[model samples]
Target chain A: MNRRQFLSWLRRLAKTAAAGVVGLAGSRWLRAGFLGAEAAPPAQRPIRPPGALPEARFRAACTRCLLCGEVCSAMCIAFPSRIEGSQPPLRRAPGAMERQELAPPVWRGDDTPYILPWKRACNLCMRCGEVCPTGALRPIAVDRQTIAREVRMGVALIDRKVCLPWTRTSWCGACLTACPYRQRAITVDHQGRPTVHPEHCVGCGLCVEVCPLRYKAIAVDPPFAPDRGAVRAE
Target chain B: MILRGWLSRRRRRWPGGARKVQVLRRTLQLLVLALLFAIPTLSLYDNLRNQRDEVGIQSRWDTRLVHRLVADLEEPKALTQAVRGSVWTFKAGELVISDPLAVVDFVAASRVPWDRFLITALLPVLLSLLLGRVFCGWLCPADLLFELAGKARNWAGIKTDVTFSRGTKTAVLAAGVVAAVILGNQVFAEIYPPRIVGAELYLWITFGTFGAGAWFFLALIAFEIFVSRRFWCRYVCPGGALYALLGRYRLLRLEVDPVACTECRLCNVSCELGLDPMGGRFGQDCNNCGLCVRACGHDALNWRLGLPPSGGVDRLGHPESGVAAATPGEPAP
Candidate 1:
């Protein structure tokens, strides 16, 4: 072959090699969970909307259409603007425009819908799933049985150290009154201290919103949270 | 041949078809813009109504008009639920439509047809196959924004003549697909302007804030203003690339009338994508927006229904170079 043709062949070979290298690196990254685990620890991970797929699958499935947030009646769902770390829940309201300017984390889909239950929890209305075209959030029926069975967003845990009833400061059954699952998810003892049944709790975070404490004695933790598992196991 | 003749005859018979198409395109563009704002506004009203019952608080914003509009409809449930999602993945009840690029990104990343992705993707795929990159011209909200940005640049006395290879878009598409496959995430949806515009608008309307995607979108607008004209759609839109590829052999193509032709170059100047309509060099890039057809003072450009010609529209001015060459019996009118 002439020198020109030889050079063209060499160029083609180099391009193929470069493409191969990129493909290899991408696969390694995917397998290593570069887009998933390394970005945020389990504890730092934001609470996903109800009926959402597991973190990895949700990231893959969600096109970040923002429909879930649009349909949220409580106006609870929020998309993180920061590239690496999500802002604290209470901080979402103030200076929203400035928050939007923050650089998003590199590896994550920036449009995924997350809820800050302490500020505005999911109403268990199941509208987000109905509107989610991607099935990132499975369309769960609004029935109590179906929501309780299918939805496992997280579980509510009461901090005895801070809770008024548990601390013997006052008779507080705010969480029990606010719990959607009522007797099934939360119950009060003779002394009127509210207890959370982790197995029955759907983690809707109604208790967290109505805790009536400055620090919020009751909070929702992801079902896989290490401390939650330990508490359940214990 | 008979169907082609009838179609061409109908187009000719439809008085002012060229101008009508442009008007229709603008109307559709405006309709899409209206829907983008309206859908989220209605949802906001619905959400706030629900909030009133659940949270025992009055909705701060007044939505009396939205309530009246919804109240006028006999059945608002389907209207509310069916008409959701952004431009990336629009759902009209059982008929879920998605952008072709989003579909490719999802499939490449997940390596699975999760949910109704394949079904949702089918309509846009078919649309591009028939009409070419019509979405970029007719319905993309970002297209409207980019055009306004271009006009603003003109008004501000900013001149940007920068140009890049059209193939850059295809390369970007390939790279995006590869990156998505490796990263196991939808890459194009994260950055595509049309999707970003829709998602950002929804965020702003519903939550009174924009996502980081809004900043990215604004940066793109700024780039278009300062660096290139319609930069994303021309040189680097992976979605536009996918649409171009899918619509490569589209049935409807822009044709120039050789007989009535005055090489005024107005059509070329009118084309947003920098395609050569004066020379009929649109190839697979003409969005069938019909802007060139409307721009022709000589009334030389019109839509033709058939497969793309073997080598682009026959060299602009040659007597035997246009549709007449293909259908021998039909002389130039």
Candidate 2:
């Protein structure tokens, strides 16, 4: 995204952050001190699975494509604007202006994970790596394979108005054509726009790849739980 | 005031005796340096021997009896010392180096700054060992620069002497020593005056350590492009003069016959160091690049089978003719 959109997103993200902190404080106070009459929101609605190992593996795979950053419903993942070159942890910046390798240092097949700072701290979304053709990131079997947890492209969100599947209006099915899912998560409507099935959405954000809009109709989004907010690192 | 006046007068008279005196002075300097270098070398031999027996490092010169004699002369302190140095290849690290102390000393008090070490090492050796001093004829970053500058200068119709002060290498050596003392190990480490072996240890070490090594390499590349006549290899090079000095005393040296010289001056024009091979001095900086020898249409400049008829070979032993046509110590005539 251009600087203007990035700034706007930052502004919107700041407001979201403030609202989240207030909600977290309210919920914690009610659950502990107030009577148990009030039904509280499920703090841990495990999405996909007990995905600790898989999430770490996904982080390893995600290249921090702004596709995921743009699609994040909760916008939990924060892409760093700057980091020191010396630190190994901050070395991975998504969209860094240099070529990168996938699994570097050991698997030396055209290592593409480097120079692109987006390589590190990906929020279990394989969108950026998927966008990369250089194998800086790889296509992995995220769920079904039961072997190693390879990063699958994270959640793809659809804008109901623009997306053909959700809006029930006439729209093209190009995003449906782009997505790798067999049971089409997105469907076209009578109008020329796209529609999304939230229950079926795996959050791969491949629709963003074909989406003509700068902020894709279908894109990857980071996990949003205010209690387990992302720990900002230098 | 007195020194300036004397230098001005001497500069005006570029006589034969002055040239001979310069050669003699350089030879003396070489002798001193050889002695200095030998002391550490012998100690290194002993270290190598010890390492062979205990540390499993095989010795190349162990069987040679001369090593024992050389080892007797070295001080104990000159054996185990390590200093900041760069080796490019994994082979170098594996080879069980015999001269750690000497290499350390050379790196620490490098006759040239770390940046210019390549020239500093190669230059003095070129002058002392063979007359073919053009590392660029074989290996030099400055040669690349000079090639660029020569094209530029030709376009501009400019011709300036690429060669300059003879003692400039000594000054460079002194500069390197001082620089090393002031700046800890890595001063001007990248693109040093020595033979850059392979990937370079400096690059590997400096990546996570001192940040300057990477920048120094970039700067050196830029200097190589912009500098006129490759001044980096010429005056600024500390090792070149040391090599020139060493070349004077080297077992093998270049000599010429004035009687045979048609004085075509092709050799002069072709010389990368700007040494006029026909200019009577047989230039200490002469790397015997043999451009003049090749350029000679007169068939005059062929390497002699042995010493010249004039017996100048006695003055410099194991003489090498310009064309490598000459034999060693030809009859001592």
Candidate maximizing DockQ: 1
**Model 1 per-residue lDDT tens digits across residues B1-333:** 989998988787454767788778889989998888888877777776665552322343435566656657887665555587768877676677888788788788777955476777887889989998988899998999999989867754568668887888989999998998888777888789988888877866665556667668878978988888887888899988888888887888877777787767788888888787666567667788887888888877788898666554322212234544432122211
Per-residue error at A161 for model 2, in Å?
40
lDDT tens digits by residue: candidate 2, A1-234:
999999988977886687589769966753442221211111101122112223333323222212222222222222221223321111222321121122122211111121111221222333333322112234344344321233322334444444444445444677777655524556655553555554354444445546654433443432322222221110
**Candidate 1 has what TM-score?**
0.78
DockQ of each: 0.27, 0.01
Model 2 bad stretches (over 4 Å): A1-234, B1-136, B141-145, B155-164, B191-227, B303-333
Q: For all the models shown, what interface RMSD does each have?
A: 9.2, 27.2
Question: What proportion of true contacts does candidate 2 retain?
Answer: 0.00
Encode model 2's per-residue lDDT on B1-333: one tens digit a residue: 989998999797453432454355445434433333333333334334544543312233332443444346555323322221122111111121211112323355323334321232342244435433433243343344345556645544455533455556657666765665454232322334332211122212111121222234435544544444555655665555544555554333334565666656765666555554554344445544455566555555544333233423322222344433442222210
